[model samples]
Target: MPLSFKPVSGLRLRWSRLFQRAVIAAAISVAGTAALQAGDDQPNSLPPVLQSSKLRLEARLAAEQGDFLHAAVALEQAALVVGDRETAQKAGAGRQQLEAQGGAMADFQSLMTLIMEQTAPPAQWIMRGDETGTMTPYMQGVFVGAPALAGAMAMTFDNSRLSTAAELARTANSNSDVLETSALRLVSLPRLEAEIARLQKSGQPIPADAAALAGLTEVQFLFVFPDSGDVVIGGPAGAWAQDEKGRTVSTASGRPTLQLDDLVTLSRTFADNGRGFFMCTIDPKPQQVQAVQQYASRLQLSARNARQETQKLEELLGLQNVTVAGVPADSRVASVIVDADYQMKLIGIGRRDGAAGMKSYFELAGRDERRGAAMDALRWWMTVGYDAIRVAPDRRAFEFTGRSVRCQSENQLVKVDGSREATGKADSANAEFARLFTEHLPQLAEKDVVFADLQNIFDLALASAMINTMDLDRQAGWQPAVFTTAGGFETQPVEVPRELMTAAASRVYRDGSIVVQVAGGIKVDLREVISNPQSFTTAPEVSSQARNASPVGQTGRWWWDAAVR
Candidate 1:
């Protein structure tokens, strides 16, 4: 008998068995402790008995002990750890059964409900274009929202043009022929949190900070064109026909008729790699954007503090009468301009001339003494050079010519300027700067600077100035207005909605097509448009082609079927 036992099949199998035994032993020990303390009136204060690492063992032990409530909780925890919705549902059913048997635990029941709810798959509402006689989809989009928020909404755009460097990169590397076609999906925070929780329980890697998850509810996807010719057909020809249920079908002889619902469904069912289908769900809840804004407000406040500190430092240095001029009248439009000019003025009290000289100079001026008395008094001192005089005036102005160029395949703004010189009075310097800037107005009006470039410059300048000049202990956080650059110029700052910012960030692809799914917060009220199909006008007939019949020369029909099935 001592020589009868053979080694295990593999080291992995042996290790797995050892691990299982250890987990079982630990679970039993914990269960024993729980049982001993079970009689304590306040079970709510008890430590967690089941752990994700030992879920299976805990479930088995609880079941053996006839502790159905604990068994149900263990089962749910196990399912969550495994990320198996089906298993979770099974645990939910088992918990319901336990509840019916005798005394039901309210906390256990609530947990079971939460597990079931969190694991349930979302519903998809799809929309398709009405154009007919074409295989290419004109417009196709879908909506998906979480169950948590009752009124969350999301939006999609067709024929959107890309402007950001990131978007352009996505388009260039995409395998799909239609680079411009893309989709944006928005999700709610609760939905995101649920996903993160599930991932955490499953021991999957995710960002540890909850704030990192903020503003991440948006996702993007590309749409790929479908293959030509039907699989059933030996040639390129295929027919559009009605199925028994009145659904539009694409098929050939001796093949299954693929029912077409919307482009997303078609792509998911027929296309490879989910090219035409958005791979993620997005939260469309308003709270998601509000979270971003709250963070943004904090950053804005920090920036304001930095500016105030800079002003105080300037006062302490006695750099009075400082005036800034030639800044773009519209800071928002400055980014798109081809050039910017600036002028600065400062009053320099005489250096090392002592406080008495400065006081007497100010006192004499305050008394309205004529220019001759001050000039004569100052001229009596040969040591004081005219240039070193307390009130010696200085003015500076410069023109920065900007050129848009592509660097590393990304649009960039390059400034060209080397010369610096002392100019005339503040009025002349400012006027000269303004005149030079106005010369580039035509170019600014015609071309738009890349939003990425503008955002980068603004963020860097603001953050660096705060950290370096103001000597801020913490780096100032500034939120760039990238959202405003994406087709949001029409609306004023106050009038623009936060949802528009989300939309701008998820703009249409470069090729001009877009798809989006939003879930949880505000609902997109497409119910009226979806329900009242009859209200839409019908497309006119094309060249005597019979209704429901595939046109001879045309590849496909773009129009929706009036009578499905």
Candidate 2:
């Protein structure tokens, strides 16, 4: 995913503001100079070199002030005045930077536009988080309750089958094989919200301070869908509904703490009206911004390269005769293949957008993606080790199955051969792994503390298992090896394999050793009773006060009959 913006690190925004003030002054000075020059009417032609130099300096000045839009305009003017290749390149780069900034500026404008257009009361305005640009509607409760669900969700991969999956995916033959995965979620949002509201409105005393706020708790809910593919963020549901009085009272403490429970309830009721799901942080830190910026830059560069290549392709292809094919409703391509005795056929379509050249685009895309995946695998090896172990157990194993190729050009197929010696229960291996984990823990924690231990075990176990199982001499149909867990609560799968069920558990539990499932916890609801309450049982004194009846056949039968009547 492309990132939103570059988070200026270390340099405070206050400093940027000061610099901007100075740049504004410079702009005013430029305006003044241009006015005076125009008044003289001396051919109104500044020297091309002088104009270009001034424009470049002005662009730099604007850039230093972080006014990328203005900087790009200056650079464009410079490009026009100088008429030099270098100047053109600089202008091109500046324009790209401005385009990137345009997205951020659009986001800012969108936010402002929303704020200005909202007709809600001033007190009802949702508080916006600086980091994620999410609005938090005021809750009718305490702020000090529960830890806000925050931080990046850790990504997990099954090292055992990753190599097989990666290889098959990269292979051209695997295109026909549809590898399907589904994302399943068990929701109790309705239940959770009602429970929270009930507790809040029970006339309970609110916590006095931050320390007392520790009593408010939140459980991390891990939703494990099938690990069929990468999990991307789905969009959020709409807002909760209000009553006739426009009351959306969720808590009693009068302080808003819009937690997951509130989201669930809101999502359940009148959706499309509330503060939607957004990634937010209490304190927007520099490190987070840097991550976003790096991603954004990489995406933008990729886009420009793609554009240039397309342009080049168009220049090469010139024009071509095109054909149209129409098939009847019941046409069959299988018959054509069968009649031809099942011969393989490959086709390529070359299309371009500009004067450069046309090339087989899909091939290039595949090659680039393959290279990126290989590079990522290498980095993962140095940093995580587990990734390398997934692909190849040792030097021998790497050579066995014929590693997947990373094609650089149409003809060149480059294979990445990375191997790590995998040994289990070996004194040296154990010692080495321990040392590595000890070194990595602190840095790993900064990213995600919960899954660090599990990932470490994954690296070791996968490496060890691959070492033992991946032997070319051994016949095919080798059962995929997996790390065995000790014991725990087990559940029956509706139809899927038992191992998949366990895999789902592993995604939730931090300790890979434990077989635990993340299930919906508890939910409650409260409503005032309008009618009088009645008792089913009576006390001894009350029992005596209650009347006793005689049998129908005796002398008192007449009295019993009368009473009945």
Residues 328-353, model 1: lDDT tens digits: 21232221111110000000111112
Worst 10 residues of 1 by lDDT: 21-30
Off by over 4 Å in 2: 1-187, 205-565
Clashes of each: 33, 13
Could you give the C-alpha RMSD of every candidate to the true structure, in order shown?
A: 33.8, 32.7
Quick one: best TM-score, which candidate? 2
